[model samples]
Target: MWHFAVFLLLIYYLINRRNSKYLLYPPGPYSLPIIGNLLSVWMGLKNHKYHHKLWQSWSKIYGNILGLRLGLINVVVVSGRDMIKEVSSREVFEGRPDGFMYTMRSFGKKLGIVFGDGRPWSNTRRVALKYLRSFGYGTRSMEVIIAEECSELVKLRASDSGQPVLVNQMFNISVINILWRVVAGRRYDLNDDRVKHLCGLVMRLFRLVDMSGGIISFMPFLRHLVPKLIGFTEMKAIHASLQTFVKETIEEHKASIDIENPRDVIDAFLIEMLSNKENAFTEEELYVVSLDMLEAGMETVANTAVFMLLYLVRDENIQRKVQKEIDDVIGIRQPSLSDRSRMVYTEAVLLETLRLSSVAAMGIPHMALEDAHLGEYLIPKGTFLLMAIHDLHNGDLWEEADTFKPERFLNEGKLVQDERLIPFGLGRRRCIGEGLAKSELFMFLTHILQKFNLRIPHGDSLPSLEPVDGLTLSANPFSVIFEQRSS
Candidate 1:
């Protein structure tokens, strides 16, 4: 029976191959029957967490545009700055994948802005951006919220001065609090156990899945066959807890909702859902979208801030230089967006962190909306798009790419903006939280630097600059002593 099944799969693969044999697909390694490149890709990702680098090495052999097949799904890994920009900017390559693992977190369907596509995604994203802006997402008001959080974090760290702080998840609470202020119109205490629990769940979720998405994303049948082995069970539990948080928040908002005057983004979305029954907005979507914002907003900013601190602590010279810049520019005043213009070296440090870390390395996979030509190769309809953003940041494009040198981003003390370094991604699918993230990172980092000196704890070695690889790059578990600055 197994032999017969294999025979049928071989015939099926042959027929599909014959159909596309004449077309010029991007070059790639050979794929076998039925499974395609699934086994090889899975093994590579499982053994080495450097998914982007693995693809980069493959791109070297198969040109800049490398192709592969995972089961029946066609994937195109596009490398280089121009090629990534070309695919990202084009409408033909703007769709998100609909694989089970991709949508499983959002209740087994593409409901949220991150994983969603088509007109519904457009409508929801439009509404989200509008409401987010109104609730101080990109405005000075947003900076105020971030400053408040940063102040609280500084206080908390100051209280624990000279202690070995596990700084890995240190920034999570503050980052999430800022997001909550914008989204739910409420903030949690710095010591809130609930927020800490959710942070733990989110970190676990990141490790369970990645940009390559593991075997379960393509071959979902294994989820039922070996749910525990593939992390399906734990993933669902995490999503459930997170979904409950969103649902409860939505309920709270609904009880106090004033449709005439929306207080926050949730209220605004609730009003839209309530007022327009004919619209695409639904209760489930509201929950999922809220989850999306919370999950996306919390992890990236916090991780990047932690990475910045790690880099600073590892190099006293760099940290002191940044502090010197901060001292020269801001002096005693609280850090603000207005100060960002004058603090070039500090800005370069943040940029270098974003580039070197490249947390969302491969980024969310994009799907082809229609048959298209990417450079010299034909991208058939339904092809998955994976841009090598990590390579764009660390590849041959930049001199001393792996070295965490902020000076590369500076020219005569003025920050040099590089088009190749797109840590927040690009084009229409760019991160909506870019403005908020920058504000949070700037405010948190500057506030901490202004108030204290980050140092490796006494008698302890420097924290590893190498990040723990996952869906995003995170600083490995480490600690920093917040020495009170004598100014």
Candidate 2:
């Protein structure tokens, strides 16, 4: 009787295994029951870079598109340029996952532009683009605003030029000022306690999100059950703090809001709120949208600028080349948008910096809206998608892919553009702040290089290039000594 039962159990196991094969999920690391590939993911999160490296390895084993069962959710990681292009552009894959953590961040609803999808996302995105463009988003007028902000930053740094200065917050303050001007029609003083506190909160939020991996992201129940243990308490506090700032700003705007002549993004949004009462627009939505702008706009540009400085200071040759290009083209006059066309090497360095330090490494995750075919595999409805940007940028497609070679972006002494170089992402959901970011990067970097010679402080050791693992990759805090350059 025991032998007969053993034979029956073996038959049952085989039958289930065979049935599972017919599910048509893309190939990935074998997942255990219930927990699914959570352990593998957790291990990767422990070392932030490992998370990206693990995905790259899995891509090789499972081909370009690989799927993993991440707890209850199905995750599909798409690698390679062609695959990313195809998957990123597909409407079926454009939806963002409505996970527990995702909704909670936006006041328990999909109220913001970054994570929200469907008609609400479409409507807000459309309005935002329209108004932002009207307010000189990608134009020469925007360059003038950024240049003026850069000049203020330059004066601030000039005061302590020869000393070793921590530039992390300095970059944050400078970048935030430009966005603040665009959005609120005013800039915060660098020494303002409120600005300092806000910057600290934003940094903490990014760090917490990175450390938790998918724990805080996917499982909302843990937040309620073990709030302190899982960082949910701290996360909520940060969210509330940011929300308070946005609310206060909006209230101030409301007091002076003009229906006839809007001052900035806040005023524009308020006007829209009054005009389109029946649309998805709301006061709450405006708060979240402003939060999104400040968070996304500030971090991406600041972090990338910091990383660019880190790279240039480490390699003196690259720095000389960029500085020489700036001197030749712009000749110490404030770098403008028009000079961007002539600064070939400077442009290449910026491109390479962006490629090497992909700020939004994995980008905000995309959801599979419905069952769809990607290449040969069938991606089921509701599967979460992560564009393997880290893998795509560092793939075999680029020669010397791992090295910090700016020349890769240059050909015949001219900047060479590649479609695969998507630092700001692609498709309908590409970062709305791309143009603003590019303008800031060019203006700030050119101004800094033109004015100062960046170096590791005298008698100090070189800082580690390894980034702090976060929602966006940022260089570990380091100091640089800037010697004023003679024109």
RMSD values for the candidates in order, in angstroms, are 1.8, 4.7
Residue-level lDDT of model 1, residues 1-487, one tens digit each, is 7589679878988887877632578888788888888777767767655777678878999998998888767888998888888888998899998887788877677887999998889988998889898988878787788888889999999899877788888988888888788899989898999989999999989987667666677677787779999888998899889988889999999999988889999999889887788864888888888888888888888888888888888888997898888899899988888999998888899999999888888877999998888777888887889989888888887898878899998998688998888888889999988877887788877899998888888788877766777788787888888998998
Supply candidate 2's per-residue lDDT for 370: 86
* Residue 310, model 2, lDDT: 88
**lDDT of every model, 2 decimals:** 0.85, 0.81
Which candidate ranks first by lDDT, i.e. highest?
Answer: 1
All candidates: TM-score = 0.96, 0.93
Q: Write the per-residue lDDT of candidate 2 for residues 200-282, one digit (tens) a residue.
A: 89988887664224576655557767899878898889989988888999999999887999999889999988887776378
User: Where is the poorest 10-residue window by lDDT in model 2?
Assistant: 13-22
lDDT of 2: 0.81
Clashes of each: 0, 0
Deviation of model 1 at 198, angstroms: 0.5
**Deviating ranges (above 4 Å) for candidate 1:** 1-8, 21-23, 42-49
**Model 1 C-alpha lDDT versus the unseen true structure:** 0.85
